[model samples]
Target: MAGYTVIDFETTGLSPRYGDRIVEIGVVKVSHEGEVYDAWSTLVNPQRDVGASRIHGITAKDVLTAPTFDDVAPALLDAVAGRIVAAHNASFDMRFLAAELERVGYVVGERTPPSVCTMRWSGAFLPGSSRRLRDCCASAGIEIVGEHSALADAFATAQLLASYLDRCGGRPMWGDEISAARAFRWPAPRPAAHTLTYKVRADRQPERADGWLDRIVARMPRSADSRVDSYLAVLEMAMLDGYLSLHEQDQLVEAAQSSVLSRPQVLALHAEYLHAMAAVALEDGILTADERSELDRAAACLGLAQHDVDDALAGAAGDDGADGLVISGISLTVGDRVTFTGEMRMERSVWEARARAVGLQPAGLARSTKLLVAADPDSLSGKASKARSYGVPIVDEAAFAKLMDRLEASAD
Candidate 1:
């Protein structure tokens, strides 16, 4: 893989599945001998909110007039064509790029050039050591500029890859092990069948609607405290779940108009909510005119002296429709069978309640079952293994949390 493309993307949020867009991208081309050839980077107008600006430090102002993803799609496709695309977290980057390319009419499937994930490779080869890009680069003495910037990260990744290759005698493949290595696939082993059972109790209740608000209030610094905490919480949760029906928007706007000191805060929160809702609608590929009108109304409210709200609206409106963030939640109903496997620290009753909230059936991995919740899907003798063997979809705790986050975000 000498002639490879080292690529990185700074995205609006995590996960391409949930509606997060790529705001910036960078690529460095290298030859088989580990010689640098060319480099390219671009700021993309993702057309959506930057979300956690503190994390990435990218704002709408940074990409106000930048080229849209469509503008750079062709050149990007050309740069990586017929070359192995490599990155630290290759799957995350590849999935977002592939989805974006697909939106622009590019075909990407099994025949596409093979891409390698340094993160995965490092885990396999350098187990028990820090495998993060920054840590690895520091160990290899690779110079990195502009850490969060796409181009800089790509350059750093290229250097790391080169260092690894040099240590291996400048060969992409291991000597005699090449043949066996060719068949290697990470995330190895299919799932197997297993049984799991948990019981539901009446004490279990769905989380209160104000749970998020309470957390935000508890975490907020004193200086940032706003007496409108309760209102803000509901609005934020509503936005996250895409729960702002057209009628709801009108009612919210009317309520804001009726309020005195609370009007600005309420309108601003509502504006942010609508911006998120519009993004979800766009991702679902089905925003009706009425929904668009509601979004417009929310945007108009933001123009009423809320600069932050306006910034968020601008970001949402410019999104490229390839954001990867996913928000999910659990909604359990009767007769939904689910299986729990492996050792869990929590009480069996607690686990059963969680399954019920998500409408899962608490049972073993039978053909009649719906889903399986495993403590360690990779465990050799756990239910995860059995579920895999039987081709059942097994979700780990973290994966399930992420799913819920995506579900919640989309619901907004």
Candidate 2:
């Protein structure tokens, strides 16, 4: 054989049988001598909520613009073609690979190519070492920097595989498997006119010559009355993290351009958004220090100066005598139902308890749900998705905490 194709997948959860899907995949090609030929990775949109993002660091927002498994199937097939597949836990990786390929209409028959499981053979190489990839890497004196990330784990596994090859006196350790791999035939997939690939925001070098908001505004043509709802929704999601990634910038630009929003109109929307946050902050008749800090961060993310925040706060405070302002479509009442999604730093039960203490009803996601609290405001969890479709405002934990404070004040 020539070399092995090492692969890894960061998935929504264990078992495609449970509707879990691959959110990201990493492939590393190494020569028989353990020389790395190429390493590639991409975020794969699962088309459903990304489950257990805490493990993989893949939020729903990260894959918002990513290519689906169907779109990237062609490229992935090409990568593993004619090569022995290797993974830390070969069965898990192989299972997901086969399942995903099958889902894309590839006739991945009952038989798959011979594969190497670095973890499976760890007992022989690093006697007494655990099967965990991190543990095996530690025993081999190899460091995995970004654990759980597909590419980082794949590269580390490649290094471990190289060590095994070196220890085995430069001969093929699995002669039978290699032979089987050589005889194995890969199923032909439908040829795609163009295949797509997308990296997570963290993987791509940011285009930071100017602020993301400015870049988005630049793409827009002047229009008298540009549609605001679509652009506003995109803006709210992008600001969830208080920092816009390159992909998010693209989303914003696309939203604005498609809506025919002009530079002035977009700027106005930004001002309105900040003002809305400010108004919400002061809804309880007081702007807590934390709320002010939150507004400041929002202002920075929107590419607005501190003066703009001051103006927004002043404007919002001036409106205190009028009907209370709602921020991003969120208006919380004492009995309004709220739902939460994604893994949060605080326990879900604790959040629910706090909600009850504040006279808010914590309930399952439904059309009647008034608010959605998410670890990532742009979470793609089923609850978050349903909440968005219902026009419920999603807020991060910090924002939720601030809201609780306001609720208590209002109740008093």
Clashes of each: 54, 0
| Per-residue lDDT over 327-385 for candidate 2, one digit per residue giving the tens place of the 0 to 100 score | 33334778899998889899999999989988889988888887788886544477865
- TM, every model: 0.43, 0.49
Candidate 2 residue pairs that clash: none
lDDT of 1 by residue, 1-412 (tens): 2277899888875545456688878889877677776887877877788644544456677677777776677667667655667787565576678767666555655432347656534432343324356656765677776666787889988887776677657765322123322442322112223321111112222233433323222222110111222233323323433335554455344333322225544544444444454455455466567655555544554343335444544565576531211111122235667677766666656877765665555766786555566665334454654564464555555555544444445545
After superposition, the stretches of candidate 1 with alpha carbons farther than 4 Å from their true spots are: 110-113, 123-128, 174-412
lDDT of each: 0.53, 0.70
